[model samples]
Target chain A: MGRPLINTLRIALHLLIIRPLLRLLFGVNVVGRENLDGVDRFIMAANHNSHLDIFLLLSALPPGKTAKTHPVAARDYFEKPAWLFGIVQFLLRPIWVDRNNSGLAAIKEMQRRLDDGCSIIIFPEGTRGQAGELQDFRGGVGLIARQNPDIPVVPVYLEGPERAFPKDAAFPLPLWNHITIGPPQLIRGKSREITSALYRHLKTLADEEQAYRQRRQPEPHRPFVAAVIGIDGSGKSTLSRRVIGCFKGESCFVGDGLELFTNGEPHDAQPLTINEVRKWMGRQAKSAKNLARYKMRKLAELLLRDRLLSEVERWYRPDHIFMDGSPLLNMTAWAMLFHEEFFNAEVCSKALDILSGKDDRLKKDPIFEQFPELKALRKLNLNHLHLPDAVIFLDVDPEVSMQRIASRGEAVQAHENTEKLTKLRAAYHLVCDVLEQSRPVCRLSGDKSLEQLTQEAAAFIKKVGSGVDETD
Target chain B: MLDAEPSIYSLIVLVLLSVAQAVSLVSKGRLATPASLPVLWGLFLALAVSEWISFIAALWILAIISFCALREYLSLVDIRLEDRWGILFSYFSIPFMFYLIQIDWYGFFIVAIPVYAFLLMPVCVALGGRSRGIVFSVGALDFGLFFYVSCMGHLCYLAFFSERIAMLMIATVAAADLIHRALRNRPRALRVPLQVVVACVLFTGLAEWSAIPLNHSFALGIIIPLLVCLGRFTLKQIEDDLGIRADRLQPGRGRTIDALKSYLFIAPIVFHYLRWFLKWGAL
Candidate 1:
């Protein structure tokens, strides 16, 4: 009577209190809850990672099932500090089995639970392994399965829960995790057969999760590039931020154009300094000396940016990097602007031709005859720069672009009026003709809802990672 | 006074969304319709709100939709190495079309693409320094410009007729198209005919409630869905010509063209029909 009443209170607490908090803190997205429907009493076997998995598994099960779901744990670990055992009783109500014994107690406990209409959740690895890597399964779960061969064993895979609540963590941190539940299987074979089958099941789930994460999540082993390029006020930064929110990993949001000139300044400073930079640009047409000085400053800035990016690549080793704008796309498009700035028009045209891969004499870099610094910088090459694998170009009308820029409280440059934005928008499209020769460019409307734009950008990145065409 | 309650429409939409999300989760992302249904509605609601504010905002948005659709169309058709300038001019004409709209130059906006851009795009393609496949590339670019830019551009032009009429046209077409996509594989459920009826009823009801000054709205409500059906058919054929698959849209399928093609076939006729009839909102 005492034990049943205690179990009832434990179930109520786990269902009403603990589950909601775990869900809020972890953001545990349970995808296959319907698989648990019509399942009466069975063992849910998952790869062991952290204590969070226990709650996540309970959350995925039917609310009524949490009352009788018995998660199997070792006696030597849980019962040692009686206070932890007390907490475990309320949270998991786990069934304790002796690790040193031959396995009769586990089989008996599972049999008893099955007979009493209770389902079992057994960590076949017997203990938590390394964070992401799956450990070998023991035959203890197989022994329980053999004792009750008619009962089904459902396989599960937990993704990134260890990042929140590992064994050695000081406390649980709020993190997003995913749970994948596979179909149930009833093994009618020897203990070794059942164990290997269970291993294969978990392994398949792990492989599928890994492949999914490789494309959708970050993988430092396979770095790729994505860019959100548009005219001013086309919400390039907003789109980048949404994509970042969708998937948190080792990602770097890159910059280009005048943004690359910022030597480790805060991101919001770009709009603040634009007016001063535009003044310098307006004066360059009247003074060749100013033009030369600007060209040298530009070269030094590019070199410094390139060196910094190289060091970041070597040290930080991001899995993926997406830029708000592409350096190649913007610089090439702005070549027309460079034409009026005491710069040679032929070289500007040739640069556009070369960047577009039309004029194939990129290595012969004596085109900027009067600007030797720019020419020498081009010859040396930018070691860290590469073309984006995926491009999201948000096309907006210049009038609307001006409206958006004015509404935002950022400092507006001299060239931010309706006419210049119009010209700049045309230049972007003109240069995009060259970009389209290479990769799939996803051009979206800035007028779309942020949700739609973010989803499009995220899908574009996944397509790029898989090396598939955007249409596919 | 009695406290007011939320409408049943919100509850219905919420239930539909929950069912869609449940199905999407159960399928493990194989079927995209159940997953993307809510997003489609969200985009439509946003369009409905933004287009009501400023006609120029509507014009710019129309340009964006046309630009993306044209990009998808160009992606489907083959282009030679020399088609860069041709494609650039093709994309360039979209902004010009909307710019004409911004300045309320309906005559130039209407004739800009078909007359001048049609003749000039071939020249730009020839400027790629090669004549081989120039004709085909130019032909392809012109075809896309007509369907995506010219036809889709007429949507904002509907604003020149009447914002109410324009809004009604958009709501009907969007509703019917979404209903069609939602029920494409649901053979047991009423499909296109059901969508047509719902959209017609929806337009007629709204037109009656808003007290539209025109006599032809009731007639338009019935006519618009049929034109949308024809548009869907036309887009399907174009997709076929481009060798796009006939399968239902999967999760990874390109939704850019799929969402916009529903408007492409009917937009021009709606604009012109309303313009010829009401002669309203024209500058």
Candidate 2:
């Protein structure tokens, strides 16, 4: 069929067939579909809610036009599997945008499609909000609407989606989602007045959504011992602060547990010394036999680092510790802490003896006070604390993470620091594994807004505190 | 005819390329592959013990290099399995192409791959009776052979210029690469392939002046490919480490082509060096 027939079918399918089904199935209600002229080429800007929102909006549209409506999804998520991705692409033909990093290409593609008479459903919130209420919108939508004044920007509100299928939840609840489409607001001016006008229009539309009204004073989500995992430099530090802020508390970025202890006063008692050992190891390194020896030694050192941290954490107890490292590293450290005798005690004693001969008491003791928070040492039953109160994973890619770290200057440069980051990243899986055994842990996508994540954390705390047992 | 003076620089270039090829192979984990073993053997003969070995050994090594290089090229490109016979004939003819050029079979050398190999490939493919416009596939395959192997066979000609000149020619290509990079680094210059070509041409002349007598050719080959290798490395870095969309033109293509060209120039040079070693500088 030609474009006209396709558009006609799209509208017919949505208005006649699909809308009725969604209304029956999801109790779907459309508020302002009439405000937006069905024929005009404009962006249907909406708040992200459910994955099903794409269909919900498509069904709400007048038939024939539904075919022309394209929703933007993150490329990394959409481009994951060829079979799934291909099927989604074939059916929806979504305008895939990389949400992890703000790339100009995605914006250009969206603008190009808009120019071509196709409508894109973009969530200005950038991602789905945990609370049913309106999340703060990014300026990207503003830029697009401002850039193309002719494309009437229609604000859409999706109500009750967070309750139906909140962030990180797998299945949608039976809660009816009321969809509201606001009147098309055009950006005609260049001054601050225009920008303010656009923001006001968006806020009004967001406020008018039935879903926002349903979620009255949505409580902020929270959990204890939130593990923030990401590559180095992806505002893990900043995100941790927001998480702490969500609890109205603060966090201290304890430097790596392994590095802290080894470099401490009783450093002579360090289980593995790579530099001194390298001299002896380097001799046979050129030969194949040394490769095996070196690998074994590396494993031993890893085990040793874990043990040392456990021993050091014997003195301190924290209300909530913000580990700079990932959950996986924390677990590994815990596992090592529990495994006591694998260490060479004779070597440890000799090292300690060497330290004791030093002039200063701090020098002689060589105790690495900065230790790993071995989960084994915690008195609280992990089963009771259960799934991480929250997990704010700074989910940026390694390159972006490195760039952020490099910009932070020289405080982070520790020996084999990169290798440690890699190891800690792997350790995050341990936390995930624990999560699988319990309930759905609240995860604040580090890739998203600090405000949104903190708000999510606050909501989580309220849920847990109120004894809303959602652990399934 | 004036005898070309023997230059030590050409031998050094050959050794360096062989070393580089070895390192590249190891990095890619290709050195452990069964097919790559023959290439390693060839490299050893051509590079390590050429002084003690006969010139014919070097010829065998060149033949092996051509064989492996062709194999690697064919594997990476998605040529259909239907064109197997054509691929086989193309590979079989590489050694013969080099051999014909080696013996100065001028007339055959000129038309051997272009006219005969191209003509025979389709005839063979038609015999399989899958000839649903197999001509285009065969034609592309023949062109690939001519470009990758036949042009590469020019290494035999380098022996005539003395090992040093052949090595220097390879180095000039490297210098051209470095010049291309340095010149292309204008704060706002468009990073296009055409720009790279322009830079290479300009830098070749400069490298000839500045790098001569001090392993100029060797240095040029080294610098150019080093830049190309770095380009490929960056492309890989972007692909692996960075969350960026990689362009369609990968650095591997640049590295492979640049490497093939440098090796093509070196093969004949090393072949001639073997000859000089064999007959006390008398061909």
TM-score of the A-chain for all models: 0.46, 0.43
Q: Which candidate is the best by TM-score?
A: 1
Worst 10 residues of 1 chain A by lDDT: A257-266
Q: Write the per-residue lDDT of candidate 2 for residues B1-283, one digit (tens) a residue.
A: 0123333443564566567667767777454322223333344345333334444555556665666455434433334335556666776788788787567665687588778887887776665457544755675567567656776665544433233333434444445444445655654234334434443454454444322333433443344444444554543442232112222212222223334543453454444433454342353
Q: What residue pairs clash in candidate 1, if any at all? A: none
Q: Could you tell me which 10 consecutive residues in candidate 2 chain A have the lowest summed lDDT?
A: A258-267
Candidate 2 off by > 4 Å: A1-17, A100-102, A189-199, A208-472, B1-283
Cα lDDT over the full model 2: 0.51
**Local accuracy of candidate 1 as per-residue lDDT tens digits, A300-378:** 4433433444444555455566676665566655554554353344454555455434554555566565444345545
lDDT of 2 by residue, A352-393 (tens): 222223212333222222222222222221211122344444
| Top of the candidates by DockQ | 1
Please report how far candidate 1 places residue B196 from its true position, in Å: 17
Q: Is the docking of candidate 1 incorrect, acceptable, medium or high quality?
A: incorrect
